[model samples]
Target: MAATNNQDLESKIATEVGHADVYDEKAAISDFKADAIEAENAEHNMTVLQAVRAYPMASFWAFVMSCTIIMESYDVFLMGNFVALPAFRNKFGVPYPGHKDYIIETKWQQALQVSGQLGALIGVFLAGPLTSRIGYRWATLTGLMLLNIFIFSMYYAESLPVMFVSQLLEGVPWGIFIANAPAYCSEIVPIQLRAPCTQMLQMFWAIGSIIVNGVAYNYNSLDSDIAYKVPIALQWMFPTPLMVLIFLAPESPWWLTRKGRFEDAAKAVERLGRKSAVNSTETVSMMRRVIDMEKSVKKPNHLELFKGTDLRRTLIVCGVYAAQNLTGNLIANQAVYFFQQAGVDNELAFALGLITSALQMVFVMLSWILTTYYGRRDIYLWGSFANFVLLIALGIAGSTGTNNAASLAQASLGLIVSVLFTLGPAPASWVIIGETSAIRLRPLTTGMGRATYYIVEIPCIFLASYMLNPTGGNLGGKCGYVWGGTAFICLAVAWWGLPEMKDRSYREIDIMFKRKIPAREWKKTEIDVNDDE
Candidate 1:
């Protein structure tokens, strides 16, 4: 009678979670979920080395998928760098009075920048449902394939309109990459490795920037169109290699478990980890246990992102990602262009951009070191505060003069901002975006959060184009004033709402949010990882 009653309770839970298929097997399953939870607790308690020994392949694949950002970043930075090259300007721009080089008009520049972001926004929303239906590996593969087709538009376009549409359509696949890459990486790795794995997005962001800027700097003097076309064609190399590799990658065990493919989930866990070190069957049960517990907490739908405790989670993610756009990411990305407008010569500006990208690679690793010791909240808050201060200084210097003295000061300041941003808030934001969302709804939540990034970025891009363009507002270095104000606002919000989630398990995170604890209390509150409840 006791056994029957226990089965009845589980049946009720399955029914409540709307998993009728699971409810049908409740009698046969017994109480293995408790054992699953216990297994998860033990694994969570594993040392970093042990976890790595167990799941090296998982780590590799996480990094491999996260590198999808490299393609998108390369494309974005390519567009920004190409504008400084005479070949690009001659191909797509009109001559301006008193200027030695042809220039893209402010309206056309804004149109090109805005079109990609708009297309990205469209793709970001679509990625959620598409990933839901097809799963991560294939969804990612589809986006990779789409990128191949879109490159034709960019490479062959003889007119601005064609380039505009190319950028717009290319954004769709990039948007898919932005939404899924980090979120997917967060899922495959053990919690201990989550921060580093997901933060690879930033590490690769620097790499992509470095490669594209390097290409532009070396080829800037070329009198032929190949200077720009070669960079555009390089984009084609990314999709094919990624597609083949993604085809061989393991599916997210969590996604497999969600689809009632418990056996397949077990196989994935086995495949993801070392055969000797991992118990695949037990691992899948642990995933099911967490997934089911989350399912009981809330429905896994887009609407749930705005409801209950999830609303807070949603807001935190959106704020974290949005914070980047406001904090001079716009300036760093267009450093070459911004440097020119600040009075530096074209070649030197592009040269400085290459150096900036290389430094960010070093600083991004420093962020990892800091994240390990200090925690996400401190990194984000302090990093953002530093940017707030530096951008203000930059604005002040920009107001000092328009000569070489002022230009060099602003350029030096911008480099510091870029390096520091990478080491702190930039990487911190990616980690937070992965950890802060409700686990069951993370893919959609991550998509929505990244969507917020582009949404905020659109206007910043518009304003940035105006600030740098001689044809528009032409604020040049003084645009720092505008960004500094926004950075401070973001910094204030982080202090009031961001939580330190260092070394947290998903189950612990779910309970803390469900209890509605204050964000600052996340550090003080103790969560028992072993507690099955």
Candidate 2:
């Protein structure tokens, strides 16, 4: 009996030892996988961050792009402000109430607005094919030349019609640059930093407005023809340096790829990536992957933007850009003129314009910071909502004939709204433009989107002029109501339809929206290489 009991105890101890060994092996395997995953995640995060940080060349390219865009912003604001410039009005022979030669009535103002828009429409429509054929770099250079020629021509114009023709020619370059610059910035930067870099374009636009107003104010005070002539002549100086500088810069890698120059494209990509002087296998592999991916994708045509697979993307982009233009932000560009109509002095009004533009620049930078952490949808919703409220307040203040103090208060509130708007949709919209479409489709779609934007903008420009006419009697406030309504529509679209793009790769974004990949399973999915290559 004692021997049998000892045998049972020995057997039980052996069984327990066997189970312990099995558990240890399993635990070791699990720990190894966790470590591997953590390492991979860290490496991936580092790679993305490094790519973003090493984008100064791309940023420089973007800055050059912005210089041309700054001209556009300068032209828009300067034209509006020039309406009130004593030299401009006097040379054009705009009549006062008792004067005989006063042909500068509301109708002429409306006509000038229409003429600019008509030229813009034609120019925007022409930009798509021109950009595709000549590349954005050349297109930008050509547009800059045209812009300078026309802007300088305005200085010699003796009549309103000649000046009108100058503005009309100016619109062509204006339309082309607007469509091209955002596309250039989007293509140059890595996916994660797209929004911030694009927002930098907006930053310069605000700078341009400020500079225009500042120069105009100083020029307005001078008694000589040099006042108007110098400011207008200075427009020629704006884009020539940038065009010459960018001419020295390399063309976009993506554009090279599109033209089937793979080797050159790879070198361009390497330069942009700023890889070490000693090339590594990993850098070569990464660039080859980008090139191979470009080769595999079907290239998009301009007409295909309105057709199957890309139609939804096209519509969303168009709607967003249109809303951007129509939301009355451009009206704010003319804010000094608006205040002047409300009885503010020219110096005080220009001062207020400078303040508003400065605030816009500040908020655009702040918005760039927010975009790094938050989802695009959240920013768009909150920003548009704030803009909605502020527009209502401004409209109310306008309708009630508020005093200078009250107007200042309303303007302050409007500045806050502008800040929020910049923080939200303004920057995000550019990001969405890049993210939503296939790589091949991006340029054409961006052009189409911008075309729609400018098309919608033309009507809004004229409408704002008509509304703000003192004789229009409360229509200006009513236009603000329209802007508020547009903001509301944008909010609804954002909540129900907008996809979350934060932290997603361009490939991941394409898969999610274009391929209908389920949100829950997206993390588990991987892109598979096609064996055909």
> Which 10-residue span in candidate 2 carries the lowest summed lDDT?
277-286
The sequence of per-residue lDDT tens digits that candidate 2 reaches over residues 1-533 is: 99999999999999999999999998965554444334223323643357565655776777777677777777677777776666666666456664332334565565665566566666767777788788888888888788767776677877778778887888888778777777778776665567677777778788788888888878876656777777777777777898788787667766776676767766765666566521223332333343444353545577777776567778877877887876667666676666666556778877777777787788878888777667566776777777888777767766666567766655555555555666677877766666666556666777788778777877777677777765344254445676777777777776666666666644445545556554335445564422111
Q: Rate the local accuracy (lDDT) of all candidates.
A: 0.86, 0.67
Backbone clashes in model 1 = 0
Question: Which runs in model 2 stand beyond 4 Å of their true positions?
Answer: 1-44, 47-49, 96-104, 277-299, 402-405, 474-478, 517-533
| Model 2 pairs whose backbones collide | 95-102
lDDT score of residue 463 within candidate 1: 89
- Number of the top lDDT candidate: 1
Candidate 1 per-residue lDDT, tens place, 1-533, comes to: 99999999999987787776667578435556655766677676877778888889998998889889998789778878867778988878899999988998888888877778888898889888888778899889989999899999889988889888999899998888898887788888887778788888999999999999999998999989889889999888789998999999989988898888988888888888888987777777777777767775433678989988989999999999898899998988888998888888888898899999999999988887788667899988889988999999999988998877999998999888888899899998888888888667877988899899899999888888988899998888788899999999999999999988888777778888888889899998988755544
How well does model 1 score by local distance difference test?
Answer: 0.86
Q: Candidate 2: global Cα-lDDT?
A: 0.67
